[model samples]
Target: MATHVLIIGGGIAGLNAAKSLGDAAGITVTIVDRQNHHLFQPLLYQVAMAGLSPADIAAPIRSILSGFSNIHVLQGEARSIKLDCACVEFDFGVLHYDYLVIACGATHSYFGHAEWEEFAPGLKTVAQATEIRRRVLAAFEQAERIEEPDEQKKYLTFVIVGGGPTGVELAGAIGEMSRYTLARDFRRINPRLTRVILVEAGPRILPMFSEEQAGRAARDLEKLGVQIWTSSIVTNVDANGVEMGDERIQTATALWAAGTEASEIGRSNGMPVDGRGRVIVEPDLSIADHSNVFVAGDQACFTHQTDRPLQGTAPVALQQGRFIGKTIVQELSGKPRTQFQFFDKGQMATIGRSRAIVEIGRFKFAGWFAWVTWLIVHIYYLTGFKNRFFVVLQWAWSYMTFRRGARLIVEKEWRMNQLESEEMLVDTTDDMPR
Candidate 1:
């Protein structure tokens, strides 16, 4: 019988794994995902800041796997994994498989406070990114219409919690947008007066990086008018704003870039999982006692090769997914499955235009050169030729003009209702006896 491989998720890991097995003659692959597209998550911040449209950083999954006739893409959510039966149950139905690969990835985590999510949305999906962009742009517009300085100040103050790469990137982009992008457009309330604050619970921002690198990033942010509040733990978050310890900042827009937990799918089937709910897989990226079932990407806790489990970075996911793919092929060919080992390609994070920090082994660098390196690396990893071409074109234009093109606010609550109505009308007409 031919081997049927079922892969959950269409993210970097899942896509890479399916590709690795695409040419294998006897293996058939099925990719299941909630969304039809694969998102370039690193650039999601750019979307939230309206620097790039969603399509620029995303591509349909079908298009990506069209070259492989053996691979099929299904648009649906996997409800649960039935390990005992070696089958996956979807919202629509269930499918049994010879091999299962789980790479559902992670989602926005509110720590212990789920209520905070209403006030501060994290950038995990395209919908959330666009919602943030609307809130940000609307804040400026609301400030312009208001007469009270206090009310206007409330609209202008923006607070970003967490000092990780996501927080730093978000704060920097907003700072630039306020000081440059919307500065000339707003006449009533000066966009330059918009206050951008970054709150970190740790001693410093970018805690994952070296102290020297972290300190440099902090300084670079200050230059862009971003106020970094270190060692400030948020006690409460509401519609009004957020309360960080004893200090309280009244702001209209509060963005969360704090932490992420494994997606709901990761917390399933009574499988052994870590604190973050990621599946604890064997050294070969397979579940214990069930080598046929594997886990990769943000859904797996792999600590065999290192003292600690690997962080859920793109490079880590890519390596894990690719290794699993190759290992499956080897097992089919009667070769032993080797343990997965991640080759650290180093880490880098961009501050703003012409400013970034990079660490690659002994080589440590920051400034414009590091920023250029960051750009080249990201451009290289983008999915399609069209994406790379347009991204480069847009980056060139933005660098030269200091402006973003995808700054339109079209998905507000009322606007979405109108769209829903239009869709209903179209559906009703299609149902007419014609």
Candidate 2:
């Protein structure tokens, strides 16, 4: 009988693993995910910033793995994993497997402030990106109608917490959008009136990057008119805005790019996990005491090759996915499983128009050339041909015209729970920019 392999999640790691195992002999793969499509998470910031639509970064899972006859795709959220029985329970039914790869990915971490999610949602999936876009565009629209300058300032200001790649990227994009894209679109709201503040608790933004690279990125963002507030910790997040220590920055929109924790599955099975709730896996990426079950993507805490656990980047996940699939193949062949070692492909982040930073081993560079490199690299990594084509075309047009075409306010209700707490009803009406 063929070895049945069950894989969860359709993100970079899971999908890559599914693709690797799809055609293997004596093996049948089953992939189950909460969403039907695979999301290109690295560029999800682009979607959140209105640079790209949701469809531009996501592709149907069925089409992605259609060429594989031995692979089965199911769209169902897993309720729990029954390791004892080698099965996963979904709301619809239960599916058993000879080998299991858990890759449920991760979600946004609000630190200890669970109440802040309603006011400030992080970028992860298409829904959260669209919701963020709505908040930004609607804030501009709301500012256009307000008569009082103070009220308009509140609406015009956008605060982003966390100065990592996501925070920096979002802040820079919003700054460019408000200054260039929507600058001429609105008559009442002056381009100079818009404010984007990036708050980071660390002493420097992009703490992972070298001091020189982080400095360059900070300068680039400042050139785009984004306020860089380092060493600032947010004490509170309310509907009005965020409070840092004794200071309160009043704004209508606050975005959280702070931190991420693994999906609930990591802790649900009683496996040992890191502080971020990522499953502590063996050198082969399998959990201790359960060699048949392996974990990948943002769900696994792999520290074998490095002092720190690998960052939940797309590249790491891609490598882990391929490694896990091959490991399973090795297991089936009665061969030894190789220890997973991540290839450090380096890191890159775009600050705004014609500004970016790239680090590869000893080589490090920033500015226009670096930006082009970043662009080409992203376009090359996107899943489908159609997605890549459209994204390239859109970016080219944006580069020339300074316009983000996907400025849609489809969802008006930006803060549902916060509004509920405040006893207010938000008009989450879908509309286009005037």
Candidate 3:
């Protein structure tokens, strides 16, 4: 009988593992995930900022793995793992496996304040991105209708908590949208007056990058009209606004790009996990005392030469995925399994259009050249050719016209409320600047 390998989570790690084991003798791979599609998470901020559609970054898992006859894709969430029986239980049924791979990713963490989630939604999934998009567009529309300046200011004020890559990117995008994209679209209020504040608890933004790079990024953000508030810790959040220290800033839209915790699977099934709920794996990426069970991706707490755990990046996940697959194949072929080694390629984050910072090994650079490099690297790694082509076209058009095509407010109730309000809706077609 062939060895039945069950891989949980269709993320980068899981997908890569399935592909690596394709057509291998005496082995069959089954990939199970909660979502039917594989999402390119690095570009999720663009979708939230109305720069790109969801379809441009997500591809169906079945379509991606259809060419491999040895692989089977299952659309289901794994509820629990029976270690003794070597089977995973889902809502529909259970499947036994000779070996199990868990690559479930992470989610937003509210830092012991779960109630704040409703007021400040984090960008993790497509639904969350669209919800944020709705809130942002709704706030602008409401601000246009309100005659009171104080009320309008509240609506125009946007707060993004956290100064990491996600927060910085979001603040920059909002600033650009207000200053450039929507500047000439409004008649009653100037969108250029919109205030975008990036609040960071740490002393500097982009702690992962060097102090020089972080300073440059901050300067670029300020140039784009984004306010930076470092060493500011958010104490409370509500429908009105966020409370930091002794000050309260009134705003209708508050976004959370703060810390993250591992998925529920990391903490369940008696798996050994760290403080952040990531599965603590052995040197070979296997669970302690359970050789047949393995963990990868953001959920795996891997410590190489550094004192801290590895950052939850796509490169780490991809390398670990390939390592785990190769290790399994070698062991099955009566060869010794090899220890996992991570090759540090580099890290890069885009501040806004035509601006970015990149660090590779001992070399670090910033500005337009880095931005071009960032664009090329991301486009090269994008999953599907169609997505890559559409993304490039959209980016080129937006760069030339300074307009975002995906700035569509999808929610119906919000639009209905704005239309029914007492304030007259200005004719957008006539008011738009030619």
TM, every model: 0.95, 0.94, 0.94
**Local accuracy of candidate 3 as per-residue lDDT tens digits, 1-434:** 99999999888899888888888889999999999999888999899999999999899999999998989999998899999889999977999999899999999999999999999999989889988988998899999899999999999999999999999999999999999998888899999999999999999999999999999999999998999999999999999999998988999999999899999886888898999999989889998888988899999998854757999998988899888888889999999867678888999999999989999987999999999998898888788899999999999999999999898888745465676453444665557789
Task: State the TM-score for model 1.
Answer: 0.95
> Against the unseen true structure, what C-alpha lDDT does each candidate score?
0.92, 0.92, 0.91
Identify the superior model by TM-score, candidate 1 or candidate 2: 1
- Candidate number with greatest TM-score: 1
Q: Supply candidate 2's per-residue lDDT for 241.
A: 86
Scored against the true structure, residue 257 in model 2 reaches a CA lDDT of 95
Model 2, which residues run further than 4 Å from truth? 412-434
Residue-by-residue lDDT tens digits, candidate 1, 1-434: 78999999999999999999997979999999999999999999999998899999999999999999899999999988888898999987999999999999998789899989999999999999999999999999999999999999999999999999999999999998999899989879899888999999999999889999989998999988999999999999999889977789999999999998897776768888999999999999999888899999998999998869899999998988898889888899999988888999899999999999999987889999999999999999999999999999998999999999989886555664788899999999999996
Q: What is the lDDT of residue 134 in candidate 3?
A: 83
- In the range 46-146, model 2's lDDT, one tens digit per residue, is 99889999899899999999999999999999998988888999977999999999999999998878999999999998989999999999999999999
- Candidate 1 total steric clashes: 0
Model 2: per-residue Cα lDDT at residue 21? 95
As for candidate 3, its clashing pairs are none
Candidate 1: C-alpha RMSD to true structure equals: 3.6
Candidate 3 regions exceeding 4 Å error are 412-434
Ranking the candidates on TM-score from highest down gives 1, 2, 3
